[model samples]
Target: MSSSSSHPDLILTNARITSMSSSPLPSNSDAIAVTHGRVSSIGPTSAIATLAGPSTKRIDARGRSVVPGLVDAHNHGVKACLARLYACSFTFSASPQDIEAALEGFFERNSGVECVMGGRYGSEFFKTYAGQLLPTPREWLDARSRGRAVYLREESGHNGWANSRALELVGITRESVDPKGGRIGRTDAGELTGVLIEDADVQARLRWPDWTAAQYEDAVREYVKVANGFGIVGSTDADANEGILKALSEVDREGGLSLHVVAAQTTPYGHREEPLDYGLHERWRELYTSDHVDASFVKIYLDGVARDDSRTAFLLEQYLPDPRFPESHRSHAHVPAETLARDYVELDRRGFTVKTHCCGDGSVRATLDAIQAAREANPARSEIELLRHEVAHCMLVSASDIPRFRRLNAVAELSPYLWSGESCVSHRRACLGSERVERWYPVKELLDAGTELAAGSDWPAAVASVNPWPGLASLVTRTDTSDPSSAPIGLDQAVSIEDALRIFTVQGARAIKRGKDTGSIEVGKSADFVVLDRDVMEVDPRMVGATKVDVTVFEGRIVYEREGAN
Candidate 1:
């Protein structure tokens, strides 16, 4: 316990600081002291004032509410940023003409570019407009694309639409076989229909030109700038890669990266029915540490999405059979059960924390079962806290798997941003049927079961914006932020505002193995916090997402300040 004057670097006074800690101090404090990028003291305004030295800067919070900076427990910053900067995307509500107009405008501007790519058209495009433009042929795309390859990733990121030239670039022909666990849409006469799913999409990406490392760095810088404006201090890059790592390291070294990041190397999955080589750890072993980067975690996608329009997600029960393929309607996992469990045991034995994308009940159970197997096979390492594995997008967890999360100490990385959105609900009902739709996201159940839970935006992939505020609000309101009049997705699963904030803060930090360093604004913890435009607790819960961030402080530095907030 050093006196504030001995090390004070900055002080914030006349503030309502919600420390998010269980300490005995007042919940709303008047002041806080920061030294060496960490909190040193917190108490009455006068108490903090007495310890401030002449060199210490002081910020007058003007009674604004301050809490630990928010974290996106799971995100793909590279993908999200690139999607906005380099791709041709339209809003979910945009009509086919709007999409065509955007594409025409894009082609007119970038005539020299070899390929046109970007997407996320909603289910309406597939369900209602399929006859008009969806099963669109190469001729339609070629007319607008000027012979350049055209690939549009669906909102789910698991499926794509490609023109004939783009398909030809990937060498897909009528004679081509659908990659195992993936599909290539074809007509009843067996002609290619230009739609690719699962592994098929991966093939397209592999053939597509890569973004230069410098471009990735620029995109990340832009993303961080946007995130800073939203009061985000850190995030977990769910789909980390060599290019992403290089970009983050460059920005961090240049003093441009304001957000702390835990980068997870994407794990290997099935390719054409055979598991890809399992030496990711060996190949990436040297990248285990870097400034603003943690490469110890690995990411895995257990299955794709399972909605009415996209039945690619692995499931415990069969989906209502498609008329085209009635007997094989249920989605399948990316990896076989035995192989997944074996890989889990191997990764656990080697001391790597893994996070898997689990959109359906079958995938969630499979992920948990793998962890349980790892625990059983590696008894010597069972108690290691650093081994806390994670499961992302627990979209449709089974009632039985709810307890397994607690028993296995698994972290549930939820994207409540989609929890109450209209498009999300429609997908559930159409793909999962009416009865199963009621079991959508089970956040409250997980929390009530004593399972650790954290929130994320899954940005660029979801149909909503990347800001976590709307997601936080959805956790409490369980209704659409865009249209509050819409029905709640699952009001029974809603959490309190305070608990929602905690999920975005403290719990998020714990999920990334940084609990002791930040999360809560306590003595000896990193001084990462946000000053809101209003007292979130006092505002209408439905309006929480609209609340602005007045100031964002990371590592004791004022990184972002709203122009008129002061």
Candidate 2:
């Protein structure tokens, strides 16, 4: 390696560097040297002082906070987590009348749109509109479309409401068949309720419309810029459809993206098959053929949200306290244990990393079983290091199975920020009593069990704040958004600030098998880190979320630096 004086790249000094390397919980150093985008050296200010030459671009951290760049093990990059920024949003606020008024204005702005796409909804906020008790559905959508066609998805992508005209465009009617894995909401009179769930005509629409790779590349650039502004350096582009691989590749070839993404190849099920569709198993193998442009991994959703009564998540016992009512409702299995095992074996055998979205104890257990079978079929180097897979939204895990995760070396890609507050409150409060809610988010439990844990926003679906500190705060405080007055989600299971930070950084990298690469500050590791405005640990644990990232780095390059701060 060339000496810093002769071939200086950059050197960050005076930082209270918190390296998550094997050194210790906290590092014994205050400065770090960066050359050729990897850490060149790290030691006390006096020790590595000789490495910084006059040619090096030095920065005075002035005791500012520095931590590993965040690596979100789970997130959706199919579109900007919030699909369309400029799209006319009819209802964004949390009230019915407010949504109606917003829709009125939206109609006026986007005069030519034939349908109101999804994103106009506050689930429980409803008022009578055209004989429908949908809060986000307003008369303006009906009036503007003039019965032409309008399809709008609920805020929760799980459900959608389409106007009569839009429904007609897709041949949807009361007489139309209900496809497998989807539901059409109806009234007692047997009239279609305009609400659709689980599945959609979206698959049909995608097949019908074909956009050039050029168009998609532009959208992706803006998407990354927007997310970077919010301090996201890494994320799992969960379950991207078949052709998306090519589209993302086009963008990469043109040098258009600044973000480091892992575009998860969609595990196409009965969802849809294309003309050139080589099918799920084959498509997966092709997707990862070249880990070009930094894209990585494959994503699969084993079940739906735990809050949905009809979601079919596998649960240990059906009679667990219902978060919607005092009595527990019978839980059902959506995907069988054997089937999941088969899929994992096929996917793992093909050399693709798998990340499954599982909630409730039953789903998690079933997933574990599948993973176990895969290991048995093809013995891994080590159970814990074998797959490096993760289970997302592990809302409720059985105590007995917690240790199994550590034994297997799997990670729990969790989202307390989603399950912690209001969304947790409005839907789950009534079903699960305070006692059950007390242990709702079991972060501490998983840590105790030796299972590695990572953090996620599950954006658009959960609508939780996107900042990592807020995620860390939620993990420790156990407080929900609606009632900040209450303690954090699982205070009993809460982790220290340092540990929570690990979940977002080094530990997160470990979840994806990137521990030796970018998670921590090491001599040969990429220069990826975040400069915080406030000291995370010293600040009130509750105020951790308020800590803003002043600068962000990825791949030994300075990707983001705040405007005014040093």
Candidate 3:
């Protein structure tokens, strides 16, 4: 072996490395060298040792496994951090009594604050009435709100339960009309129930107290620490408003960011009449573009969740009969087909990647249609083909549309956190029927169709933690890693461990538009990888979720090291 002209900055040896590269290395290769934040050399330990100078740092992996740093294709980075740090938090499976107890404790701790925000009771909580009933959601929240304006987001983040003070503050009176593409729950007499769905929830949340810049900065810092600890080197912030973007930009500017964040600026959801602020996206791109922050992405919600109580997801078939509405009702798209196609074409032309939230088969089809329109509209532009627009949350895609994903060069951004047979899945089955529920996720079929699959945690929305192991495990086993006794929802949809890893790594980076720079451990790419506590490939499929990150390295720098780890 010969040494290079310049010495390396860091080296790792005596470990199993999954490079995820197209080219295969020697069978005996087990070392990597990094210089100037990029992989400089990769070969056997003895060969790479010759490239190291006196100042180069050497790490002995001691027979651990190393893989490319994970990427989360869809996440609300700032919102998740804020909720973890300040909100009255509860699990998606928490009971009404549990939620009330959480709220009471939060209120007592922040006695002087006028507004309180927390959430995430399961969607089933709204329909089951498992606890004492009040006249309406407003009364139910009022009893536990301590006279403070309270707004608790539902598990799916598409609905909310607000106290009277919150409703009054947000100006939802008896005469208030439901916003287009959303609903305001009401009693038979047309009185407000303090249940806001779809755009109505957006309205209340926008009107709620805004956090200060300092608060946002703190949240951004905390988010980086949490994400890096979980082996995430990069993520796409699913919804980034001005506040979130500014915080991310400032952090990256100050050289405090350890994660690459592709900010998907928020666009109007469920409002077909509203125009997308293309100018706003361009302006943010110019102002917030930094070393680690890319602001050229945008997020759109084509429809809401598919759960029965909400009945907001745009479905191809009619939902099961419910007392709340007409028997023939199948939810509709937020934007008309023509409008969606037009917007998508323009966004695609402008070099912006769009991620549309599609929870139902109908919405999935509509999104694919729009992408097809964009491709046809700009047949000559190579950039159009490169834009890889995404259908976020492909919870239920019609069997026919599966091939369109690969044909349109689109990405299926799957949230593994929701794939398990959890309570929320049961709620979806109640409205969606057994046949539709049985086909949930369809991971293997998408892969077989040559569709690029990207994995995301959707943290703090449906899932409580950012840990990817459990979700990774669920991808292969189709069962909740947390509960061994739980049944698998769609066992046939399970993918292999190798496919699951690729989805979380290279595919995720591709979804965020950073595939060329990161996502793999090949030479000349960024030195971003994680040392695992165990070899996930050798572990029992059911125990994959129990895997942990012992050390996370980003751009050749060790960012997170577990305490007492070898």
Give candidate 3's error at residue 67 in angstroms.
0.6
Model 2 lDDT per residue over 195-258, tens place: 6766553443442234445545655676566555555666666666545566666666666555
Off by over 4 Å in 2: 1-5, 24-28, 44-55, 90-116, 127-140, 146-148, 200-215, 269-296, 308-311, 319-329, 380-385, 419-421, 432-435, 481-483
Give the higher-TM-score candidate: 1 or 3. Answer: 3
lDDT of 1 by residue, 129-182 (tens): 666664454455566676778888777677788889999989999999988867
| Global lDDT of each candidate | 0.81, 0.64, 0.87
Candidate 3: which stretches are off by over 4 Å? 1-5, 127-137, 188-191, 383-385
Structural similarity to truth (TM-score) of each candidate:
0.93, 0.86, 0.95
Give candidate 2's TM-score.
0.86
Clash-forming residue pairs, model 1: 308-431
Error of 3 at 202 (Å): 1.7
TM-score of 3: 0.95
